[model samples]
Target: MDIDGADKQEEKPVKKAKVAAAQASASAESAAPYPDMALAQDIHRLTMIHAGKLSVDDATSITGTKPEDLLERVMLRVGAGSSKPFDDVIKENEEKYKAIEKEEGKDVSKVEAKEKEEQVDDSEEPLLNPELYRHLQSTLAYNSSSALSEDQLKTLAAHNESILAILAEGVTKAKEEAGDMEVLHATMEIARYQAKTGTKESALAAYENVLALPKLSVGKKLDGHLEMARVCSFWGDWRQMKDVLEKAQKIIASGGDWDRRNRLKAYQSLSNILVREFEPASKLLLGGIATFSCTELCEYPEYIMYAIITNLLFLKRTELKKNIIDGSEVLQVAKEIPVVLKLANTLYECDYKAYLHTIVDLQPHLVANRYLQPHSGYILRELHVLAFQQFLDSYQSVTLDSMAASFGVGTEFLDMQLSRFIAAGRLTAKIDKYGGVVETNRPDWKNARYQEMIQKGDLLLNRIQKLGRVVDL
Candidate 1:
């Protein structure tokens, strides 16, 4: 009996050991995120390093990130001088392992990076370009009260050419040597410089070269693609911006962490906004508002405004009240941008005339916005259509003169506006030109379903008739 009891005790310890081992293996397998979560969220886009032609004060007001702090972040990416290669900070990172499966016979995380040389004090292609840095430093002196003189612009154009020539030579050498790290470093130096001081077309070409680099990890490639989207966005090229964002999405699918996935969502939302895809844009923007760290894309306050505006367009009354009117996030920033708040409240309160007038005043803001300027025409059109629909919703038919007076617009002017929207099928209403009345026709799901069923029935009857003829033959 004593021997049997001792054996059972030994078996219990063995079982415990096995269970502990299983738990440890599971933890290691699920080591999804390697770096600190905070570190992952702090993505480095060109916005952090360059403010384009804006002086320090102007850039600060526009982006809400101080130029000096942006410069400091730039120093982190590169160093104070030629002490670092453009990509040494990332390339020299310790060996990283992700438990991601190989796809298409390529392990994205397995790309080999060359070790950093002990002495990189004078790399042929240093991360910092003194010429560009001087320009950025000088911008701070003027406080952005005036634009640059033509002579200064000409000097800068020449300066950028000289720097590009030097960077290109280094890139050529790295290509000849077949060093992956050197190639990446050299290429990024050119890309970063172009993004900072050159034209949008030049910056885009440089980023395309960066993405074309061989054997870069998916993460690195995504960074390049996202930056390209930003460049395209700043220049108001939605077509290219849309393409870049699509490419970034595919890279994320192969392998990505939580932070990068969310970053892509933010970029996509902006694209959707520009394209007038308000539904998806509203969802993403509103959900991401609280935790939005993509300050490189826009300021936090700007993000909140987009969320409110988009939701206002897409959401029903209950949802608008729940999410925007009463939501703490929207309320907190609403007062700061009184114009946007007034726009939202007027619409919610059914003050149609006031809403249209406020939006008229708001048109200049939209037109001047770097991101929304291109779509300002379509946006204004949509806002007018929405107001018309809401105003006509309560009546089966209303005289054109009465409708125009209600909106505080002239009868002839309102007639033209309603006629345009009606023709475009944007408004669920019709204008009776002879009767001088507007008649509402809100969509009915049952009517649509009935029409679909009749179409299907006709198709089935034709098919049966053909089968009967074949049988007769």
Candidate 2:
């Protein structure tokens, strides 16, 4: 029995040893790979160097990484470090600079150091044409003011040929420093010079530079885009004009009071492009007309007028003849114009009759006045007349329901016109306790000015209304 018990105890010890060996083998197979401690230390050292806590040389020595490699990595990760880190680097560099200065201590400050640094000559050297520089500086200063003399502008233009390159460089540096207002003013002066000299390319380049500036405010950006578009149009670059107008549209669509002028200018620019392109006018007209109508409804009559005129011209030329057989199509296009005119007259609170006459007479020159160009006027006027007619024939008394139903536009749009009319004393509204209107005054057809506006509007309306007339079937 003792011998048997000893054998079992020996077998148990052998079994335990085999089980321990198997467990060890399994752990070795399943264990994760160990990280490189040396590599981890190097990375930590680089991080410290990047944080400005250690010099690049010290970091390199400690981590055993090459100085160039370490610096490349550091720059890649931290983007050349902060200004404070740069200042530290400069301080570190100063000792080496000073050692060179001491070694070349033969009054080297007086001599221009070609080896390390170039000393600036503080001595006045007649300003390298002092008269010209003074003139350029004065021109810059004058342009910065609200009103500049014609002679001053002329002088600036004359001297611009000599100093424009220098001025552009200075402006670029100023923009980089966030002093872009001065640069903008200087660029405008330069643009004027370019325009006067008929240097369309230079003018466009200057305007484009202004547009590319990142730090400009939204208003300035809009102005730049509009100006650039105008310049591109003058250059007869329709594709570029389209691009600038599309960008301007994006800016206008993003709802803001500050953008009103931009929105107006953008719509006008787009209208000109469509007039010029004379293709796909319908899609452009329908897509943006609603937004522009809303703008007009919200008291932006000029913009509304612009949109209406553009769409009217587009439809008059494109859809009027083709879709004349369809009553709904004719009515749909016709209804949009009068609502726009009614809103414009109501909002501006001017004599609608006088305004209509002025518009008709001035229509030939409206494009010229707006864009300061003569070529675009005639086409713009034709379009304006077409829109005026459509509005007259489709005139449903400017009631809330009629206005909404006629345009197939939203109630908020009609309400905008109502609000503007009420404000202008042309409309009186009866509102409930919640500021919702119960009733509103209908436009008086008997008023002399109203009748005249309608009469003048009819002259234009007659042309468009003829499109909807019964054909001899």
Candidate 3:
């Protein structure tokens, strides 16, 4: 029965599997470039036949192949393989030929030859007239090593704007070729002189021209951007100021080693824009703080501080004459505030004492409604003292451990407080000499209060030590 069934099945159907391998192999070979260089050349030749540069008959005659096959190969190489489109490639070749003719001065017609020779002689003469030369010399001499006199700069700036730009460019080029640092120094002096004498527009134009020079490096570009941003900020052109800062940030982010001072200045300019414009200040600040926390770049602290101070000042302004506080909103703001302050204090010239004083003064009022805590007040006191001590004693630099010890708490507790300082731009953290471990400092301690506190803390610590020694004896 089984044998009979098998025979019936065989008679009923015979199956065959269809493989697509042969078709795919053919398709791949068609897509690939010719393996032989001679074949590639033949293809390229055929493509050039209709390219208008070569006659189709000549192309076929040279390659000893049909115009169609030559065209196909050329299209495959230029259009689809190793060559460009036939028309474009031919046009480029034609342009090159014309350029060679132009370089050899073969394009000069008989009538124009005599005129061209005369023109060449005219071009050899210096463009600067006697009077202009005298003025240029006097200006260069006066502004050589020092800042230009206000009157002289004003006089020069009063001339055509393009003249100032040309002069600046010339100076930049000469200095660059001469490898003289003093050139930039002199240029800045001239710019300052112009700015001070009411030729700010010309001065900026001159600086802009200098910045636009190709020889200027990334560092120089940043300097120019920073200077422009500063001028714009002074003019209350916040938008342009922001734009320049953003450009500087991009340059720096792309591995440009801008001077530290310029980086900080750029950040300050951006922060000022945020504060003044009130456009996305909070988000920018928060993002900047987060970036600093992650990257630990030099400018991160500056950004974090800028955000913290701007936000705190904003909040402080709002808090005045307000009794009802939204807990969720306040907490959300508060949480980020510490983070910003912590980063700020670690790296910037933070006004820790002022920030602490502000926090302390406001804490009592805030605590009444359970907005802050007693511990928060204590942390402020400790921060103030610790920062003060650091400011007083050169060796006693403020750090999380020192701050924590002052409050009899762990580093974690101090870290929380430090976060607020970082957010506020009063403090910053860095990898210490020990490596991998963090250290902290207050960047904005320039105020007299911080100095005063430092002195007072020194006196108080001394007295306590003396009393303890007496009691032991």
Q: Could you say which candidate leads in TM-score?
A: 1
lDDT of each structure? 0.59, 0.39, 0.39
Q: Name the runs in model 3 displaced over 4 angstroms.
A: 1-177, 180-186, 258-309, 313-473
lDDT of 1 by residue, 227-279 (tens): 77776664446778899999999898999766667777888998888777888
C-alpha-based local distance difference test score of model 3: 0.39
- Candidate with the greatest lDDT versus the true structure: 1
Off by over 4 Å in 2: 1-159, 169-180, 183-189, 196-198, 251-473
* Cα TM-score of candidate 3: 0.27
TM-score, candidate 2, is 0.29
Each prediction's TM-score against the native?
A: 0.58, 0.29, 0.27
Whole-model lDDT, model 2:
0.39
Give candidates' CA RMSD values in order: 17.3, 31.4, 31.1
Q: Tens digits of per-residue lDDT for model 3 on 265-308?
A: 43453544333443355445433332222111112323333444
